[model samples]
Target: MNETKAATASTPGTHAHTGMTTRHDTWWLAPLLVATGFTLFIVYATFRAFENNYYEIGSIISPFYSPKIDLPGWPFSPAILILWMPAGFRATCYYYRKAYYRAYFLTPPACGVSVWGSKSYTGERAFPFVLQNLHRYFFYLAVLVLTILWYDVFKSMLEPSFHFDLVTLIMTVNCVLLSGYTFGCHAYRHLAGGGLNCFSTNESTKQRFKVWEFVTKLNEHHMAWAWFSLFSVGFTDFYIRQVCAGVFPNPVFF
Candidate 1:
């Protein structure tokens, strides 16, 4: 019975290795890994912001505004960051993937008559590219965030009690960074274009349209601000995090 069992096990296609599955062969691995990296960077920035007590609005030494908010505390290891990276928002990568696939991959190889594997005579514009819609929403959010951050800067400058220090300097820089990010966003560019055809119909609207035209010229380099603002945001958040962590000194330039 033992010999027969051994022979059966040794037979071709009869036995399979039961090892752990690896992520190596997965098609989604690249995008998944990129998403994970983004999450970690944001989380680290959040942790540093909390450490510096960035959430505290009124005073330097006070606790953060949100009692429920929790970011991993430091002398934090990278392993902890990596493990926590997959916690949420698996859908974000789809946005990034689709945007890039069109901008970089799909558009390049497309041919005039060839229609990119689609049916002949079908119009792509009829479907109206959905990913482009995100630029508008992101633009509005950028403007909102920039306004808030700038308000914080103004508020800080207005405070007589704070005195001139590192916190104030950082806040000022943060405001500038946020503006760069907001102005650089793709949607902001569109708005700057004076392309709101319906908005231009009125005599009064024409005056505002001229201003938008002027600003749109600056906004035309959408990609420039996109990258600059992206990095600046990370830097601003990093500075705030450092202030929270007590690892860095908070400056207040009054």
Candidate 2:
């Protein structure tokens, strides 16, 4: 009886050692953490997007509301417009797709775990998954948005008196994190020179090769930058909102 039960448990297609029955210790922890963190960010961002009143303070604009476009007759939040590009870029991001797919969809949630959905895995070959191929295009838009945010950061540092402030420092840090993530993107690394057939043939290609190497180093820690930038952007927005709402006072230091 014991031998029969053991054999049945080890049989393929039984899922007796996979899915909820995974034998690997702490295998479920990673996906659970990812799901919790991602969900919290989504909820906070959604609330902030609709509650747009506290997005600006004096000369500083919240990261969430940069490049503000006010349409006199528009019915919805302007944030929706500015956010859509970054959101799309992130949605199509290679690392993010893996994280969310595991966390949210439970598609093979973790290593050694049985895959969810149908028995046959048709990965990215179908309708919505095909859209991930647009990541490169989204990377272009992300660069445009990053440029705008950097401009905002510079503006935040400029006061009539030339003194550094808390918001200025915060914006600077946010810009650095965001730039790290954006520049470290896989598409950006490819564009830098990953596609080159011959790096030694020309000086220009050599320079591009050097740049690609740097970006490649950055890519090694892309997942860390992704989470850091995600948190930084939201925190920056929240700080700006607090200042705008008179909930917190902005401090200055020379």
Top candidate, metric TM-score: 2
TM-score of 2: 0.91
List the candidates' TM-scores in order. Answer: 0.49, 0.91
What's the lDDT of the predicted structure labeled candidate 2? 0.84
* Whole-model Cα lDDT of every candidate shown, in order: 0.44, 0.84
Candidate 1 TM-score, C-alpha based: 0.49
- Residue 114 in model 1: shift from native, Å? 14
Instruction: Give, for candidate 1, the lowest lDDT window spanning 10 residues.
Output: 107-116
Clashes of each: 20, 0
Give the alpha carbon lDDT tens digit for every residue of 1-254 in model 2: 25454344434445443464435478679899989998999999999989978998767998887889998998888898799888998899999999988888766676546555444455787888999999999999999999999988777777554668999899999999999999999999999986668998889999998999999998999999999999999999999999998998888887
